[model samples]
Target: MDKSQLLERVIELVVDITGEDEVGEELDIDLFEEEILDSMAAIELLLAIEDAFGVSIAPTELEREEMNTINKIVARIAERL
Candidate 1:
């Protein structure tokens, strides 16, 4: 998928995993700061991202700060893709 499509899918996964529709609409929001993504939810997100993009996200490979926002998550996935 292209970058836009990848980002949309990431957003969808975030919204689905977090059960927060606002996250899908706010691309730049800090998911952790907003309390939309806690530790458990983050694990779910990483798994979903892997399933969706076929990109493995080794937990130790990324710092929480590096993947705390939708934009950052998209960039990381795009890079892996």
Candidate 2:
């Protein structure tokens, strides 16, 4: 899928799992700092992303620096794809 589509799906999954409608700011914004993503949320997001993209995300891939924002997450997934 395209970046925009992937991002939207991520946001939808995140919202569904977190029970929050607003995701806040832009894709570049740090989800942790925005309090929109925590450890639990991250796990849920990772699962959703994996299922959506049909790619497995290794646990070692959840680097804090690499996955701090939605844009980065999408980029990583795109690279894997």
Candidate 3:
């Protein structure tokens, strides 16, 4: 998938996992800082991202800070893709 498509799917997964539509409200907002996502939800997100994009995300390969926002997550996934 292209970056925009990837971004949309990622946003959908994040919204579903977090049960907060607010995630879509700000593409650059930090989910952690906004309390829209927690550690458990983050794990769920990682798994969902793997399933949705067929891309593996090894925690050791990157810092968690790289996943602090939607755009950043998409960039990471795009790199893996």
Candidate 4:
């Protein structure tokens, strides 16, 4: 998928994990700093991303700082794709 599509899907997954529709409004916000994603939610997000994008993401393979925002997540997925 293209970047916009990837970003939208990532945002959707984040919304599902955080149960916060408002999160979609701020694509650049830090999920961890905002308390929208903790460790457990991050793992769940990784799994969801794998299922959605057909890309395997090992938790240990990525730094939280690299995947802490919707934009960052989209960038990472784009790289894998």
lDDT of each: 0.88, 0.78, 0.84, 0.90
Candidate order by decreasing lDDT: 4, 1, 3, 2
> What TM-score does candidate 1 get on C-alpha atoms?
0.94
Q: Which candidate number would show the highest TM-score if scored against the true structure?
A: 4
Q: Taking the tens digit of each residue's C-alpha lDDT, what string does model 3 give over 1-81?
A: 777788888889998998888677689988788888778888898889889888877656767678989989989888888
Per residue, candidate 2 scores C-alpha lDDT tens digits across 1-81 of: 777887787777767877767663476878888787888888877888788888788767668779878678878888899
Off by over 4 Å in 2: none
Report lDDT (Cα) of residue 33, candidate 3.
88
Models 1 onward score TM values of 0.94, 0.81, 0.90, 0.95
Give the residue spans of candidate 4 off by over 4 A.
none
Pairs of colliding residues, candidate 4: none
- Pairs with steric clashes in candidate 3: none
User: lDDT at 7 for candidate 3?
Assistant: 84
lDDT (10s digit) by residue, model 4, range 1-81: 777888888888999988989888998899899999999999999899889999899999999999888899899999999
Per-residue lDDT of model 1, residues 1-81, tens digit only: 788888888888988897888886778878889899998998998899888889998778999889988999999998888
Clashing residue pairs in all predictions, respectively, total: 0, 0, 0, 0
Answer with 2 or 4, whichever has the higher TM-score: 4
Which is the better candidate, 2 or 3, if ranked by TM-score?
3
- The RMSD (Cα, Å) of candidate 3 is 1.2
Candidate 4 Cα lDDT to native: 0.90
Off by over 4 Å in 1: none
